[model samples]
Target: MDLSNIPKPIWYALTAFLLLTIGYGAANHVPGLNSSDKESAENKASTVPNSSSVKVSVFDEATQAPVVGAKVIVESQGGSDTDTTDNLGAFRVQIPTTDYVKVRISKNYCEPYNQDLNLKSNPDRPKPIFLKCSVPQKKYMPSS
Candidate 1:
């Protein structure tokens, strides 16, 4: 017998293991090599319109600066309120997607303003809207 000759079963087992590992990897990686395993509609629909966030800010119409500690109320179809603003005067609110309706801002020193909003609205991304404080009428101007 030749010493160079080795057991056939051991070589076969090694080859099989290597081939199995390669096949498994290719099946998962290769698109055309394996059957497609895709997500169902329920998974996507359940996550659609996932918007539930709103941003509110208060600024002086003349100064154009953020109003810190300003009171902000966001009334949507689902009725939601935004979290209090930070030192920078930025408030973020989370509401239902279908609830995108209107937003109201109030402050003792300034007038209140209401705006209609929807999920399509882009408020979070640095938008500036002018709001003027209510001016008191002098005795010279008579009320209606």
Candidate 2:
């Protein structure tokens, strides 16, 4: 290979092509440098697994009726999930797989209920929460 005889422009073009090939290869093949769209998608999927749709239903304990507008809070290792009861007094939430979680239910004029539930065994089952409700005594007036 005699470099003294070769033209300068031709050498520069060849050098540029070689550098580009190496840079592209490194960007696609290197571990940390090769963060493509596919790798990011896989990372997102691997972050959470074994998630289940846990159905939660809130009801009035005294009347045994559905309690609308009730707040349902589920605390787990991943994070806390909260939702208000709909017209059917039910809502579905995604709970990541864990040993146990704290479930809290609260509504107006009702005693808040708190409990720890283990949903690992059966995660798809509907959990019914009963909130004790109370009514204030009515006052009477006598006129002479």
Candidate 3:
């Protein structure tokens, strides 16, 4: 390709236009990149007033004891909220009233739990989750 015929100003203008086009495309298509922090916060605030508070309690399936320090993540189209269970093995989160949410619970010592919740159709309190995990075993070796 020969570029000697093209003027420097035209080349600079073409480069600027290409950059602007790419930036606009990325800002529109990429998630979380299009909106400013304040705008995103405002959007969340507008939806939160109509949200419902969902409480989740975790327990061990074997012993039925409360599972403490478990991590709970609730996700929906709006966003996601994460919390850790306290000594009572319970955590609460606010989710939009009309969206379906995916709830995930995890603990190092117990099996992970996942459930899909329909907040609009159900409109009822969620059920508690119980995790079942196998007991860890130790290995023994003969001394040399």
Best by TM-score: 2
| Candidate 2 displacement at residue 50 in angstroms | 3.5
Q: Which should have the higher lDDT, number 1 or number 3?
A: 3
Q: Model 2, which residues run further than 4 Å from truth?
A: 1-49, 136-144
lDDT of each: 0.62, 0.76, 0.75
Per-candidate RMSD vs. true structure?
A: 22.4, 21.4, 14.7
User: 1-144, model 1: which lDDT tens digit per residue?
Assistant: 673466788778888999999989877644345665574331232233554556656667877777767676666565455444557667666555763557777766677778876556564563444567554565777779
Tens digits of lDDT, candidate 2, 58-77: 88888888889988888778
Per model, state how many residue pairs clash: 0, 0, 0
Residue 120 displacement (Å), model 2: 3.3
Give, for candidate 2, the lowest lDDT window spanning 10 residues: 39-48
For candidate 3, list the clashing residue pairs, or say none. Answer: none
Model 3 segments more than 4 A misplaced: 1-47, 118-126, 138-144
Cα shift from native, residue 29, model 2 (Å): 41
lDDT of 3 by residue, 1-144 (tens): 998899999999999999999999888644477765554532352347667777777888998888899889888776677878979888777666656779899988687889886666545565577899556776888899
